[model samples]
Target: MIRRKVVLHFPREKVDKPIVSKLVRDYNLDFNILKASITPKEEGLLVMEITGEDEDYRRGVDYLEACGVEVQPLSQDVARNDERCTHCGACLAVCPTRALYLDGESMEVVFDREECVACELCVKVCPPRAMEIKY
Candidate 1:
């Protein structure tokens, strides 16, 4: 299966649709919603991980675009600058996936990129501004 992280932008008119559910029922794809902001009559943002056969994934993405939901890679949202990081471990407390952790021996913060789901929690909490979200 191919796995991809993506951000979906829903226009006001499409905000109430069961778009993600359709990906599962119609396209036979699996999805995990990492973050979401969906308010009635307003634009919505959904961060999700989509998994399926390569062809199915492509078709599902096409379907979303057809429905007027803008799709972008999740990597575009969050990043950590190691050069600016002091390894103070402030991000560790808020990382839901344990992507940010403190090394017991070294007493320094470590970032595991693969474990990050791009939730933007670290970006908001980082005092040194090492964690940044490109939006």
Candidate 2:
């Protein structure tokens, strides 16, 4: 099966509501909540990992965009950054996908692109701006 990381930026309230539920139920896609940064009963962004057939993936994207959610395909290059990296673990905390982790012994940041949803939260959290989306 083809897997795609779809990032949805919307008000926090919109998540776990009818809109998200419909997408999950209708598409029959596997999804995982990666990040939630909104206040209680307020707006926030949600990062989700989606996996399904190509057709279903496209349709899912279309459906989400129609609902006014900013959606995009997760880029692998963005998930793995070799340069401008300090491995400070700042990105680790913000990563909703838990794709980035620091080696406790080495004190280095490790990246698993497969687990990344490309929410760009890592890019936003990196102090040195080391993380980048290749495409």
Candidate 3:
């Protein structure tokens, strides 16, 4: 199975559609929604991790784009600057995904980029301003 994080932008008209469910039923992709801001009749955004076979993943992405959903990889959204970080572990509290954690042996902050869903919770709580989100 392949797992990848992606952000989906839905137009106002598409807000109420059952689009995500279709990805599973039609394209055979499993999805985990990390964060979402969706209101009927308003533009919507969803951050999710999709898992599937290589061919199914490609087909699901293409299907979303064809239906007017803008799909972007998670790398474009969040980043951490190691040089500016103090490893204070402040970000760990607010992280919903447990992406930020302290090393048991060293008591240093450790960030796992792959597990990050780009929710930006760490960005607000970081004392040294290490977390950054790109709009």
Candidate 4:
């Protein structure tokens, strides 16, 4: 089995298409939508985690590309600067993925980079301005 988080950019013309559903019906892939902003005649953005067999994952992604969906990894290159981090645990409160948490021994916040899905909730709530998004 394979699990991948990706952001899908659907063109304005494709916004109303049943593209994502094809992943489930045709590729036997399961998905969890983290966020979505879709409008007819306007661009659509969908962030979702896809889970399926390895071969199915590849085929599904290929299908999306063939359908004119711009597929990209979920991460937005978010970085945390320890020097500027106050570790007040503000970020821990808003992180939905358990990406930020307080260490039991040291009381400092620990960041699990692999677990982060670039939700940007931590960045918005950080007080010391520690979290950064690198384009």
lDDT (Cα atoms) of all candidates against the true structure? 0.89, 0.73, 0.88, 0.90
My TM-score estimates for the predictions, one after another, are: 0.78, 0.54, 0.84, 0.87
Local accuracy of candidate 2 as per-residue lDDT tens digits, 1-135: 677665577756566566766666898777777655666776656656677788887888888878777785544456455787877788877887678988889989999877766667888789988888866
Backbone clashes in model 2, listed as residue pairs: 11-44, 12-43, 12-44, 34-96
Candidate 2 displacement at residue 132 in angstroms? 10
Tens digits of lDDT, candidate 4, 27-134: 999998988998766899999999999999999999999999999988676799989998899998899989899999999999998778787887878988999997
Candidate 2 TM-score versus the reference: 0.54
Q: Which candidate is the best by lDDT?
A: 4
Q: What is the full ranking by TM-score, best candidate first?
A: 4, 3, 1, 2
Better of 2 and 3 by TM-score: 3
Summing lDDT over every window of 10 consecutive residues in candidate 4, give the lowest-scoring window: 114-123
Residue 83, model 2: Cα distance from true site in angstroms: 10
Query: In candidate 3, what are the lDDT values of residues 38-111, reduced to their tens digit?
Result: 87767999989999999999999999999999999876667889899998888888888887899999998888
Residue lDDT tens for model 1, 1-135:
899999999999988778889999999899999889988867999999899999999999999999999999886656789899999888988999898888999998988877789778888799989998765
- Provide backbone clash counts, one per model: 0, 4, 0, 0
**Which pairs clash (backbone N, Cα, C closer than 3 Å) in model 3?**
none
> Candidate 4: which stretches are off by over 4 Å?
none
